[model samples]
Target: MNCRPRIRASLLASCLVLTVSSACGGGEAPHSAAVGGSPAAVVVAISDADRAAAKQTFETVCFTCHGVSGKGDGPGSAGLDPKPRDLSDKTWQASIGDEHLRNVITMGGAAVGKSPAMPPQPQLKGNPKQLEALIQHVRGLAR
Candidate 1:
């Protein structure tokens, strides 16, 4: 038996799976272009009120599953299969970037082949501004 042919076939299958997944909206949401005409120039400006509101929202809805410190150690997390993500990890957050975070929160991680324990926050219930603030707050925790 030629192992090389088998390995190539397996690799091709894996790549096909990943490609199909991404094409079917199983990847990060596309980033919005900034007013300045540069995708990289887009910046979310959060106010103190927005931050406070986001903190409250996170405390009320998120803390139950993500923990008070965003460490994925919430009381409800005990029964979860995949468990919540540790928000305090700067490395992970940094690697994913703001766009990915927004997508995860808006569309959910499960939509992107991540842990399905994370549910999407409907835009109607979660204001974009508040969400942006929460993202900033999570980013601050990465240190």
Candidate 2:
């Protein structure tokens, strides 16, 4: 069985969804508008597919340095000067805000005066759904 084709196809589909969503302004916004002047603050649920994609992305991309459990002890972190952050740290998680997380994730750690080893994910700047899914996934690791 050739798993490469399946993996390629899944990646292609995910990329298509991301491209289409960005092109169609599928970023953050209310699912429906309210009857009043301002929009409602209804929480949008993350689909299982998106959640799975986020997990895959984290494993493939971030896991190189952050590890599968976000312990900052991945194989790639061995050579890094400053170790990657442990995502499950309750104190650290409580100290940061979502916006700060978003900024660091999108603009890299150095952008927020953190570690320069954390590369910026410019691709996620336009895809709020995936970005938010990744953020939520990180938040879920809090221990």
Instruction: Give the candidate number with the greatest TM-score.
Output: 2
Model 2 clash pairs?
A: none
> Global lDDT for candidate 1?
0.65
Off by over 4 Å in 1: 1-44, 124-126
For model 2, the superposed segments whose C-alpha errors exceed 4 Å read 1-45
Candidate 2 lDDT, 86-112, residue by residue in tens: 998989998886667777898999998
Specify the poorest-scoring 10-residue window by lDDT in model 1: 1-10
lDDT of each: 0.65, 0.71
Score candidate 2 by lDDT. Answer: 0.71
